[model samples]
Target: MLGIKHNQHTNLYARKCNMKKHLSALVLAVAMILSAISGVLAEDITTCTDSNGIVYQLSEDSSYLILKNAINTTGPLTVPSEIEYEGKLYTVKEIASKAFCGSTATTITLPSTLTYVGDMAFAYCPQLTKVSFGRSKVALGNRVFAGSPNLAGITNYSGVEKIGYGVFDGTEWLRTKSISTVDSAVYLGKVLVAYFGNASSFNISTSCTSIAPNAFNGNTTLTSIDLSNVKSVGSSAFEDCINLSSVTFGNSLVEIGSYAFDGCSSLGGEITLSDTCEKLGAFAFSKTSVETADLSKTKIESIGNGTFKNCDYLNSVILPESTKHIGNYSFQGDSFLSDINAQNVLTIGYDAFRDCSILSDKEYFENVESVLSGAFDGTIIYEDVNGSALVIGKTLYKTEETEINLAVADGVKSISPYAFYAAETAQLLALPTSLESIDEKAFISLSDGTIFVFTKNEQVYSDLESLTSGTIYVPEGNTIENENVSVGYITGITITKNPVKTEYTYNENFDPTGIEIEVNTVLNGKESSYNISQIGYEPSYTYNFSASPIVTVSYCGYETTVITSIKFTSVPGDVNRDKNVTSDDILLLRKYIAGLVSEKEVDLIASDIDGTIGVNSDDLLLLRKVVAGLVSLK
Candidate 1:
């Protein structure tokens, strides 16, 4: 029995030892697997230096590698698209910032897989002369080749999209290539890199699709540029080109980068943009001399900050319906900018039109969702005679007076939003002929009994008709027929000057040769005049020599008559008072000359055959000769 118990204990101890051994083996295997994973992760995040002294590091996401630094690299360097390391293939996707800066590489070849070249990637590389980009499209960061004095050659950048500011500045390539007369400008494939020529005018190549930043910056000699085929203009492309007076933008142009034409003081005339242009960058035309900015044809949604700022000659700006915002200081300091049509604008930024002294249309901001501080600082404002109505620019902003006749000034072109909303007690509101538009809800608060008197402006009348439930009155014939409107000839007509010839014989037509008719009417409570012909004036009268006749002038359903004396007059040769000249008249003239009839009894003036002072024997002789048909009276 003791021997059997010993055997059982030995078996149990063996089983326990076997279990412990299995557990130890399992723990060792797990440690090895975790170590392998840790190694792999470390390797993925580590930097690698190749035999050629080029350094590279795995990207943050571990999908690709970035060429980090090539400072120790020498001779011609070729960056492969795929680099093999530890039996793994990784794509070289980017050239990191300053990767090749201060390197001794004489020539460099970039890989087709490269998507980005970071800022100053090849800067300060004095010995680097040539660079070849295998891929056409890449995002080039700022000053990529700046300070590379000997670098002069570049190839294959046609499809590049984003070019940072001063990419090729201070490079031998830009200095020599830009001044070369071969193309008159430095071009990186189809991209216009720079213009260093002395030409006063330049026409960009039709093949160029993009303009690099600072391409024409500070160029004093260039007066005009024709970019008819370019699609994009980079930031500061033409900044401070003070002498550049004319720029012909193409229909293909879609984007203008920030500060593109800033400080171009000589740029003048109307700026006509194509509908295809969708983006206008900040300070694009600031400090220019342009007279008008008619961007109504563009598809741009915003006017960027300082776009037309300090444009001394800019007088008019027509914003398109697509425009939703006006950025800060857009038209600020444009003293001559008197008006802008921004009916579709949703918001206006700070100082958008500040210091625009003549800007009068503050009504444009009435419906905007946001209007920042000082949007209209120095604009013109006018007050009515009674100080009840306030007008800004050509817009009637608001009125306070009630239960009285209100007449808007003649130059008020628009009625601002809610201009008359509080004037419910106003019985008569007269608008001038100069009114062009009435903003939404302009007359919403007016009562049904409030009468509106306005002249014939189709747009104003239509707008007013839609706003007010009150009665409208227009001049008789000038009325735009509408419901709840009264049309009566309140106009008056007066014959200011009668005809020069007032005397008329029997059965003669009354001539109005020298008639001066004045048609006067009350418009907006102010006396106004209309041309006689414009009022359809007609003159009507009957001729009667028996007494003074009345000449009546009719205009706009109004009539006025003028009375002038008309004396009875005889014919030149009627001596018998019978209105006939014959042998009897000659016998009567002879009797008058022979004293058979007194001078007063006969028609002495008529019997005078000659126009002498007195009728004597010469008159009788001429009368007898007249009877014989030998001679006639003078």
Candidate 2:
């Protein structure tokens, strides 16, 4: 009784594509040789019957889709590696896309000379019981037997390098009796399996380079293991291996993926990563019972959220200086984890280290900017955002922004998610270092959409609609994502925040507080201003004024007006110019203190670039630097 469910069974066979990129030229050469042996492997055809009583034919000569096109019947059919036709040898060279899809075939035997298998080739082959890769030099995929309902067995005799993606995607049979490395393969050391049956003991090798994802997804009985030479591990490689009490990595691997060890409850040991690895994908070491993992030499830039969920035994963690940021909720679910020390981290992502039961040690929260929602909801200490970490152009940006513009620090590697989100209308934004990723709803909600900044991570920008409804601009960079029109205006907005600046807005007729201002009227940015008191007599006229400046008048009882500022050089000899200096400066005239202003600055009060205390020639030069964009005094 076979039935199709909407959405559940849609396009199960859609991914039979064998881009075959990972397959080396030597493998192709081997296939060509085998084809040549078949006397032009283009003339032979294998005639077989499907379970639905339809006669089908596969021509091994010129086309790979020959048999797939004639499908009608369905059953557990084993297409032979070689079919004898007129006493001539014909190689089973190709398998078309979704050829055996939705068929009740319970077993499939790939021919020894099969050179190509199309994408989603056997998807929905519901009753598939076994899939064996023959002596054909090609590698087998983790997806080959995916979605096979009763697939209880799989074995590839070839010495290929990897288990491709989506292979064995939804098979029920797990818990290996024995899986070991054969010829050509150096050694298949840690093919970790999940508990499926009553198997008590298992075997492991010392030469395996990777552990397949979800290899032991539901195993409960497998308790202890030793892997000393394993190099690389894939995502969720040992996920849900419930009974895995203890395990360790071999000495050679560097990179680990998200959720590599997630759900392994009882593993307790001193686990450390090799110095050579660079990428620690989203949740690579999640949900394990390792007491203290050492990450001293890792060059990690971002720590993903939920990477350590449910790890109850973690009491301490030491992050290396090479780390720059930790993503949202990266350490949220660790119920027993207490302390984390990260000295060089710049921005803690949204809710990063959230709910960390005992997170008050001071080593990780130092020098941080833009803590997102719930970042310290239950932390033991109150840590403030680092005002100094807000930088632009490789130096801390001390000036406030009516808008965002990160023109220079192109190599800056972190963004505090929604650092400067504000209430005023902004016109421009600039993003550099090819942005990495944006968190959920990182942008502010607005009626009119605005552009988003960019770093270079592809996955982050692929589906940006999850952030907001406003239009966004994503600049093109060295590494680009989809380049799609569906994702708002993907254009690079140039930041021309040079010395030249101005702004204006029009109003209705007979405006009172300015110089002939009216609705729908515009003025140039370089030369613009308003004339105050033209409509009424005003008292404050003691300042440099620009011609035709824009005026803003609001009523809070009587109306008060605001206008644009004109650049003006300060009076040279005014020590207490605006009378801002209180009697406190007179009582502090001690010796030269480094934190305090110097005597030169005190002698020339007008030259103080910064308004704090004394002023001198250093202060004079600082004033010049501020105008020159080298120093800041705001």
**What TM-score would candidate 1 get against the native?**
0.50
The candidate 1 region of ten consecutive residues with least summed lDDT is 1-10
Q: Model 1, which residues run further than 4 Å from truth?
A: 1-75, 83-93, 158-162, 381-634
Q: Return the TM-score for each candidate structure.
A: 0.50, 0.44
Question: Against the true structure, what is every candidate's RMSD?
Answer: 23.9, 17.3
Model 1 Cα lDDT, one tens digit per residue, 133-206: 98557778899999988888887766566678778888877777755658578777667877777789887887
Cα-based lDDT at residue 529, candidate 1: 48
Off-target runs (Cα >4 Å) in candidate 2 are 1-99, 103-120, 126-132, 136-143, 146-194, 197-203, 206-210, 218-222, 229-243, 254-257, 275-281, 297-305, 310-327, 333-349, 357-382, 385-634
Candidate 1 — which pairs collide? 360-393
Q: Candidate 2's residue-wise lDDT over 1-634, tens digit each?
A: 1111113322231121112212333465776788899876543324533223333344644333233531332555555454322234345566666676667776666665665555567766766777766656544434555677677666664433344456555665432233332321122213333223334344545545566555555667767655555555667766777678777555566667677777777677666765655667666556777778677776666676666655667777777787777777777766567767766777665555666667666545545533555555455542332321243212222213334332323443334434444312223333444344444434444223343344445654653545433334443332223333223223321111211233322111222332321111112222222221222212222111222243333211122334444333333322333433323232222222243644433323343446555543455445445445565444
The model with the greatest lDDT is: 1
- Note the Cα lDDT for every prediction shown: 0.72, 0.48
lDDT, model 1, position 597: 80
Kindly provide the TM-score of model 2 when superposed on the true structure, using C-alpha atoms. 0.44
